[model samples]
Target: MNTSSTPTPESTSRLSEPVAGAPLVLPVIEEHAVVGREMVETGRVHLTKTVEEHEEALNFTLLHDEVQVERVPVNQYVADGATLPGVRYEGDTMVIPVVREVVVKRMLVVEELHITKHQVPTQESHRVVLRQESVQVTREPAPGTIIPPTASTPAS
Candidate 1:
C-alpha cells in the first residue's frame, strides 16, 4: 500500500468573479412636464390721422389732425452681472451694466384726398420715444443669521 494519499481536485463552480469590459444595464424612467408661455401687458395707445388735397383748375380740400398721449406704469428690472459667464449667488452686489429704458412706439397715419392737391405727398411715419420714469429697488437679507468674514476679525 502506498503511504502517500492522492491529491483531490478543488471545485471552482461555486466561486463567482467579475469580468472586464462587461456592459452595465440600468432601469429607464419616463415622465412628463407641463410648459406655459410668457405673459405680456400693454397700456393705452393713441392714433392720429391727417388728409390733404389740392387742385389748380378745380376746388381743393385739406384735413389734418394731431394727437398726443401717454401710457401707464411699466415695470423694468435692471440686473447686474447678468451677462457674465459665471454663476451668480444671492446677496451679491454688482453694478447694472446696461441702462434700463422704457420706450413707446408711435405711428402717424396719412391719406391723400386728391393727387393734384397732395402733389406726390409722402406716406406715414413711425417713431419711438423713450421716457424716464422713477424706479424703486429693494433687496432682502439671507434667511440665516449673518456671519462676519474671517478677514475682518483677528484670529483667536
Candidate 2:
C-alpha cells in the first residue's frame, strides 16, 4: 500500500503510529520578514587655505667707528741695559712705548704712542611709511543656502 509520496520504511513505521484518530497529519509553519535599503560610505570632508604677500625695498645704512690719537716726541737714549721697547704693531697702527728717567740715570724713550683705527660708511636716506595688510576668506551660507561658484569664489 505504498502509493509513492516518498515515505518508505514501511511508510515511516506507519507515520510513527497514530491510527486511533485515523486523520492526523500534523505539520504547519510560517515566518515572514523582508526589508531592504542601501547607501553607506561614512566619511569625507576637508577644505583649507593660507595666503600672504609683501614687497619692500628700503635702504638705510650707517656705521662710524673712528679713533685716531697722535702725539710724538722721542728724546731717544736707551743703552745701558737696553732691551726695553715693547708694544709695536703697524698695519692698523698701534705703537706705544713711553719711558723717562733722565738727568744722568739713563733710560729715556720719552713719549711715543700713535694709535689709529677708522672705518666710516654712511648712507642716510629717509622716506618710509609702511602699513599694508589684507586677507579675506569667507564662505557664509546657511539660511536657505546656495553656493555655486568656484575658482576662488566669484559670483557677486
Candidate 3:
C-alpha cells in the first residue's frame, strides 16, 4: 500500500497561516500644538488738558504829591541892602519868599504835600485742569482656535 508522512501540529499551523517576508505597517495619529505671538487691538486710553479763565477784582491805595498856595496882606517896611525871602526847593516842593513895604508887619502860611512812588511785586495762584494718559493690557482669545483641514489630512 502507498502512504504519505503524517503531518505534525507545527506543520499544520504553518499551512493554515500565511508567512510574511516584510514587517507590517500601521497608521499613527498624533495631535500637535503650535505656539506663536500676534499683535491685536484691545483697548484705548485718552487724555485731555483744559484751560480755565476767571476774573478777579483788586482794590489798593495810591499816593501822589500836591502843592497849594495862599496870599495874605502884609504891611511891613524893609530897609535897603537887606536880604528878603528867596526861592528854594525842599524834597519835591518849591518854596518862594515874599516881602513888601507895608505900614505894619504880617504873617504868611504855605501848605505842600510830598509823595514817593515804589513798585510792589506780588505772587498769585490759580486753578488749572491737568490730564494724563495710561495704557491698559487686556487678554483676549484669537478669533478661531480650530485649525482648518489641509489637503494632506484624511477626511472624516
Candidate 4:
C-alpha cells in the first residue's frame, strides 16, 4: 500500500516486501571515472654557428737581462805549491781568473774576466686578430600548428 504525500519510483522500489522467511537485502550503487594519457609532438629547433673576427691592441712592459763581459789581463805569478784561486764576486760583477802553467813548474795568472748584468725595460704595442663564435636558434612549428610567444637568453 502507498503511504506518502506523493508516490515516487525510488520509494516504491525500496518499500517492496520480500519472500516469506527470506531476509531483506538492500542494493548499493557506486560511480567511478576512467583516465588515460596521450603523447604529442610540438615543434623543431634549428641552430646556426658563425664566427666573427676583430683586431685588438695589447700593451705591456718587457723586461730582460743584458750581460757585458770585460776581460782584464793580469800577468802575475802565484806562490809555489799554493792552491789555485777560486772565482770571486765584487759587488754586482763576477770575476773569473784564467791561469796558465809556466816552463819553470809555476802557475801564472794570465787574464781575469769580469761579467756584469743589467736590467732593461721597454714598452711595446701589438695588434692581434681574434675570433668569436655565435649561435642563433630558429624555430619551425609542426604542420598546422600555432607558435606561442616566449622569452629567451642571447647566445654569446
Candidate 5:
C-alpha cells in the first residue's frame, strides 16, 4: 500500500481574512464649577452709662445702727470674819461693814466711713475718727536709779 498527503481548498480560504472597525461613536459630558465666600458679623460695644442706669434702677437702700453700753459696779468687803464677829446669817447686812472702792476708767471711741462713685465722675473717700481720754502719770524719782539715804530718804 502507498501513503500520500495533500492540503484541502476549504482550509486555505478560511486562513486569509482581516476584521473591520466599529460603526458607532460615544458622546462627551461637561461639569459645572462652583465658588464660595465667607461672611462675619460684628459685636456691639459695652456702655458704662447704661450699666450705671441699670444699677440705679435696681438699687436698694439699707440702714443699720449698733450701740453697746456697759455698766460695772464695784463694792468692798471686810478682810476677816473677826471684823464683824457674832453674825448669825452668812450675808447679814448689819454685821458686814460697808466699805466703798473708787474706780477710775478710761474711755475710747472709734469711727470709720467709706464712699464710692462710678460712671458720672468716679470718687472714693475714706475717713477715720478716734477719741480717747488723756492720762497723766507722774513719778517722784527717775527710773533705773537708786540713791542711798544720807539723811533725807524716807520709806514709802
Candidate 6:
C-alpha cells in the first residue's frame, strides 16, 4: 500500500504565495536534454564483375593430356583369313581408321587404336591476370549533421 500526504488548502496557498516580510526561498528546477542514436541507411554498394585478359609468366601446375604417336614399320602383312580391328578414340588420343577384307572368311575388318596416357607434371608461370570483382568502401554522412570521426568512434 502506498501512502501519500495530501496538501490542505491553507498549505497549498502558502506554498504558492510567498510571505510578505520574510525573504522567500524558492526551489530552482533545471531540465536537461536527452540525446539518442538511430540507425539509417546512407548509401548503397554495387558490385560488378569484369573480365580482363593479360599475358604474364607464372609458375603453376596445369592438368592436361599429351598424346605421342610413334610409327613402327610393319613389314609383315596380315593373313588371308585375318580380321582387323575397328577405329576408336581413347581419352585424348584418336586412332586412324584402316579397313581390311578377309579373302577366305569374306569379313570386313577395321583398325584399332592403342591409347597411352602420360601425365607430365611441370611448373609454369602465367602472365598478369585481372580479377573480375573487387571490394570498395564508401562513407556517407547523415542528412541533418555529419558526425566527426572522433565523436562517432567514442562509446555511446
The whole-model lDDT of each prediction reads: 0.37, 0.75, 0.49, 0.90, 0.36, 0.58
Q: If scored against the real structure, what TM-score would every candidate get?
A: 0.15, 0.30, 0.31, 0.58, 0.19, 0.30
Worst 10 residues of 3 by lDDT: 107-116
Q: Please list the residue runs of candidate 2 whose C-alpha ends up more than 4 Å from where it truly belongs after superposition.
A: 1-50, 69-71, 76-97, 100-104, 116-121, 124-133, 137-139, 143-156
Candidate 4: tens digits of C-alpha lDDT, residues 1-156: 567889678666765677799998888989998898887667778999999999999999999999999999998989998899889999999999999999998889999999999999999999999999999999888768976668888999
lDDT of 3 by residue, 46-151 (tens): 5454544455544455555444554434434444455664566666555555654443443322322233234444554555544455555554445554445666
* Candidate 2 lDDT over residue span 54-142, tens digit each: 55557788899898888789878889987889989889989898897878988988888899888889987765555655555554455
Question: Model 1: which ten-residue window has the lowest total lDDT?
Answer: 108-117
- Which of 2 and 5 is ahead in TM-score? 2
How big is the RMSD of model 3?
A: 16.8
In candidate 3, stretches whose alpha carbon ends up further than 4 angstroms from where it belongs are 1-45, 88-95, 99-156
- Tens digit of per-residue lDDT, candidate 6, span 1-156: 224488666665635566689888877889999999998766555555456565566678977777676443333345555555445676766665444545654444343435556787777776776555455555555567556566556678
Per-residue lDDT value at 42 in model 5: 32
True-structure Cα RMSD, model 2: 13.5
**Winner by lDDT between candidate 6 and candidate 4:** 4
Better of 4 and 5 by TM-score: 4
Best by TM-score: 4
- Minimal lDDT window, size 10, model 5: 106-115
Best by lDDT: 4
Better of 1 and 3 by TM-score: 3
TM-score for candidate 6: 0.30
Candidate 6 or 5, higher TM-score = 6
Residue 150, candidate 2: alpha-carbon lDDT? 69
| Cα RMSD to the true fold for all candidates | 40.1, 13.5, 16.8, 8.2, 41.0, 13.4
